[model samples]
Target chain A: MIDLLYFAWVRERIGLPRERVETGAATVAELVEELRAREERYALAFADLSSLRVALDQELAEFDAPLAGVREVAFFPPMTGG
Target chain B: MRVLVQAAPFDFGAEAQAFADGAAGAGAIVTFTGLVRDLSGALTAMEIEHYPGMTERAIAAIAEEARQRWHLIDALAIHRHGRLRPAEPIMMVATAAVHRAEAFAAAEFLMDYLKSRAPFWKKEVTAQGADWVAARDADEAALGRW
Candidate 1:
């Protein structure tokens, strides 16, 4: 199981900030695919992979990053900080 | 280098002064304050959200890079999260160095990284409604120069 965190619009669409998911996915992309299959909300939030950014265990990572031993995964829109 | 991520309002003038004073033997001190700009009368407030631990770590790494690239005597970055009003200060970056060039460059670099690399997200609330601020391509491109 891993903590899945959503922020900003992703959170609004998913209607929750975070959740714990039990998965056997090998990569972040595989996990995304599993989540997308679970419900329509996840599918909508992740409809376009280009529009979303992911962080593995609090560090910016690519979708293909391995999830082994990872504890947290955050999905959000591109950062708009200053 | 020092990085502060908080929801509370910060005293810009006092913080800038203190940062400058703390850098012993530095001849140049440059500070940039980012304000929540509202051009239209409709804008009421801006809400900023961030991942706590990552926010601090990312900012500290950016500050460290600035310190390594420039001959800065000291550097400080302060960013605020949560609901904020127009004209309110959103963040500040200050750099102290022996020369103005290093101070200015480091401060600019800090701003650039803080915009794209940091984990904060912003939502702008107007009289009509609230919307998440879109990330700009220009912000991402700005990183290429450095």
Candidate 2:
């Protein structure tokens, strides 16, 4: 099981802050595809890949990055800090 | 280097004084504070959300980069999360260096990275409603200068 976290509007759209997903996906992109296929809320939150950023185990990563041995995945819009 | 992510309001004056005093050979110290702006006059508060573990790590990485690039004597970053009222400070960055140029540049670099690279999202709460502040393209462009 992979721990998934969502923030900002993605969390609002998905109706939760975090979840534990059991998946066999091989990469971040594949995992996104799996989530997108699950429901309409997931589809809407992930509809635009360009607007979203992803992190694997607390580090920024590309969509196609391998997820083997990864424990946490986060999805959110571009940061507006500072 | 010190990075703090918290919901409590920080004492800017005290922090600045402490930072300046702690720098052993710093010829210059630059500090920048970002405040919640009520541009529309209708804004009641700014809500900031951040990824718990990643926020600190990302900020530390940015500060580390600034230190290495500018040969900084020390660096400090403090960012607040959760609900913030207009005029309240949202974050602050301070850099100490042997020269004013390095201090200024390092502070700017830290701000630019913190704006785009850090995992913090801001939502403006106005009397009308609440909306997430969209990431500005200009902010991303600012990173190219580094």
User: Best candidate, TM-score-wise?
Assistant: 2
Q: How close is candidate 2 to the true structure, as a TM-score?
A: 0.99
Question: Per-model C-alpha lDDT, please?
Answer: 0.94, 0.97
Backbone clash pairs for candidate 1 read: none
Q: List the residue pairs that clash in candidate 2.
A: none
lDDT of 1 by residue, A6-57 (tens): 9999999999999998999999999999999999999999999899999988
Best by lDDT: 2
Which docking band does candidate 1 fall into?
high
TM-score of each: 0.98, 0.99
**Which lDDT tens digits does candidate 2 get at residues B71-112?**
999999999999999999999999999999999999999999
For model 1 the local lDDT of residue A20 reads: 96
lDDT of candidate 1 over B1-146, digit per residue (tens): 88999999999999999998899989999999999989787789999999888999999998988998897899999999999999999999999999999999999999999999899999999978999999999999999999
